[model samples]
Target: MFPIVSKLPDVGTSIFSVMTQLAQECGAINLAQGFPDYDPPLALQEALARHATTPGHHQYAPMPGLPRLREAIAHKTARVYQVPAPDPATEITVTCGATEALYAALAAVVHPGDEVVVLEPAYDLYGPAIRLQGGIPVYVPLDSPTFRINWERVRAALTPRTRLLMINSPHNPSGAVLTTEDLESLAALVADTPILILSDEVYEHMVFDGVPHRSALQHPALRERTFVLSSFGKTYHATGWKVGYCIAPPALTAELRRVHQFLTFAVSTPTQHALADALETDPAHDQQLPAFYQPKRDLFRELLAASRFELLPVLGGYFQLARYSQISTTESDVAFAQRLTRESGVAVVPVSAFYHNGHDEGLIRFCFAKQEATLRAAADRLREL
Candidate 1:
């Protein structure tokens, strides 16, 4: 074999993929990955079918995106956040998915030795993507249990080398939602600095209990400097579609597009048209997300209430974290997660997978964005524990 240098020497297969594969091999209900077992809304499926058969729609979309799609996104953003609509021509760039948006954003802005502050436990991709760009990831751990941001700790993490701060609301793994005050503190933190914000609001519509998912774009101080990313996959239950977008100021969007054009010049043309149709025809789809998902969240929680797993509060997002100390203190989270997959006939992601240093809180995360029957069956197996 040729001698090779690994960009991510310490990284291995993602826990999500590993656990999902284990679930498949074990014939277990897979709640480890954050994707619904069910299909997307019928309206969305039909739109795709309509466009897929349309002549002349298979060609490449504009480098930035389909005009109609970008316009639809801008309209949705302005309507949902009550902020001014971003210029579709200059401020939005559609990509393969939020994953690509994240990579492009980091590659565009992060130079070698620049420090990017990331809150942990973060999405598994955040650290690796930052590292691949030769940027240093400065991790600030969120408050445990609630998983809320600690602004003072974030403040302490900043240095003259800090180029960007990455944040996620309706946060992954923890389901913790950021409040308006949290955004205020963030705006104040980077007020005088040249630091940029990367706000990952993929789970924007999934907040429960009447709590709002605060976007950095909503704040005047942070809006221009923030790259707000949202996922069509997350919103439409079409993770396989791999479509998401970035909304930033024109200047920032230009930089993002410089990298984006080389990465994936244009997203799937037919998919973009379908998405545009869905957005315009079924605006209620976005509005109904909370009511649709909240019931699943509640039902899963109620079913697990009597189990040995101590369920944590899910303020937003679809994942539910449960402490398994009552079940086993001796087993590491990874071993327990694996054992549970093999023995209990259910799969989960150990919370430690999200930490840079493998910090285990004896907690495992369960994705609740599944069909009611799937959740109930998984809950039945879980209750046996």
Candidate 2:
């Protein structure tokens, strides 16, 4: 065998994939992965069906994106955030998904030995992606339970080598939404620094209890220096479509495109056309999302109310974290997750998996984006535990 050196030596298959496979094998209700157990909106599906057969639309999209789709994205951004619309021609880039957007942004900004400050427990990709670009990842733990950013700790983590700060609102595992005050603090912190921001707002429309998602683009000071990434898949319940976009200043867009052009080159063409049509045809689809998801979140929590698990508050996003210490004090998060899948017939992701070193905090995450029947069944199993 050839001697091959792996860039990500410590990395294995992602926990999402691992738990999902285990769920499949054990015949468990698979809630470990952060995807809905339903199809996209009927309008979106019909649009895709129409575009698929339309003549002359079967080729690669432009390097940036389909003009129509980019324009739709621009209009949506302005309408949702009440901020100036990004110039679709120069400031918005359609990517393969938010995954590609994150990687490309990191590749574009980080040089060897540059430090990227990341809030933990972050999405699993942040640390490894930074390292793959030869950038050092400086991890700062978020305040536990609430998963709120401690601005002072964030300020302390910065150094001359710091190049980027990665943040996710409606954070994964813990569904904590960042406040406007949080953005104001962020704007002030990076006011004089060369550091850029990567705001992952894929869950922008999923905030519950009247909490609005505060995008980085809304802050005038942060807007110029931030590369905001969002996913159409998350909003539309079409994760398999893998269509996401980035909004940045022209210069940053140019740099991100330098990497993005070679990364995926362009997203699927018919898909973009369909998305554009869907956006225009059903503009209120996103506006109705909180109403769509909040009931499911409440139902899941209510179902488990009598169980030993302590359910955490879900301010935004579809995931829910539960402290399982009362159920089993001896098992580590990983072991408990596996046992829960195998015996209780319910699969979950251990919160520790989000950390680089697998730091356990007695938490496991449940994806509440499933259908009513699915959520009910999972809850039934969970209640028995």
Candidate 3:
């Protein structure tokens, strides 16, 4: 057998999976993986069961998506973002998950030797996805303690070779949400440039503290050049369902479909019907999410208040970043995480895993997107530290 060079040569088992497996092995309360411990809406489950046996949906969904699902998404976009409802038939492509949508979008826009500007301590998938398309990922660090975009730094990274800028808001691990000014900065930076934007907004519905989520679709200049990817799983508390969609202009959608046709052909048929029903039945479900999660965040923080760990502001997302330097000065973030998982019986993801060079900032990320009991139990364990 011939030895083959790995495409993502440095890639190994993801930290989420590693931490989850360790949690399982050690009987730890697992907060390392970003998923809800509770079941999705009972209505959505019943809808799935009803639709799964329906004759028309038993087979494959259309390559772009189920029309009804796309329509639901379009209506939601129009209502939420206050933009003209995109033509569902022409502008939306349902994907297996936001993960696939992001990868397909990257494959569509990036060519060999092209560059993609990535915000560091970002999602782990961005760099590998860009690299797979033979594109270079030019990293810029987000301002720490706040994880806000440093627009000047982003501007400095742009070159004529740049093909795309990827961004995530209600950003993962950090819990920072983007504001309108950030969007305006981005709009000005890419003006008249050939760069495209891949906006990963899976956590769009989870902003907190009376702040509104600023979608890329809301900015005219951004909407013209951005491929907005969102996850239904994240919204519906059904991460296992893995259903997500993309919204872009006609031309970008056309290109995305070119790659998406081969990526997964279509998302799950019955799940699409279920999600469509969920959206139609309760358009305000997303609006209720922050209220639903805020108490849990408060509880988790209150439990940890007496501990040595200092919690950062969690403006959005279910994750919390805690600086652990006071407790373990000798260990790297990775070492600290592993030792904590084994000793304290609480698992977490080191924020360094989201970086290009594993830059440790003495911070670790905990997914608070769990059941209340789960959060309480994890907090109980963590308080022992």
Candidate 1's displacement at residue 25, Å, is 0.6
Q: Report, for every candidate in turn, its global Cα lDDT versus the true structure.
A: 0.94, 0.94, 0.92
Q: What number of backbone clashes does candidate 1 have, counting pairs of residues 3 or more apart or in separate chains?
A: 0
Candidate 1: C-alpha lDDT = 0.94
- How would you encode candidate 2's per-residue C-alpha lDDT over 219-248 as one tens digit per residue? 999999999999999999999999999999
The global Cα lDDT (0 to 1) of model 2 is: 0.94
Ranking by lDDT: 1, 2, 3
Candidate 1, poorest ten consecutive residues by summed lDDT:
281-290
Residue-level lDDT for 201 in candidate 1: 92
lDDT of 3 at 329: 92
Which TM-score value belongs to model 3?
0.99
Cα distance off (Å), candidate 2, residue 97: 0.8
On a 0 to 100 scale, what is the lDDT of residue 116 in model 1?
100
Tell me the tens digit of each residue's lDDT in model 3 across 278-306.
Answer: 99999999989999888888889998998
lDDT of 1 by residue, 1-385 (tens): 8999999999999999999999999999999999999998898898899999999999999999999999999999999989999999999999999999999999999999999999999999999999999999999999998899999999999999999999999899899988889989998999889999999999999989988888988998899799999999999999999999999999999999999999999999999999999999887788889999999999999999899999999989999999999999999999999999999999999999999999999999999999999999999999998
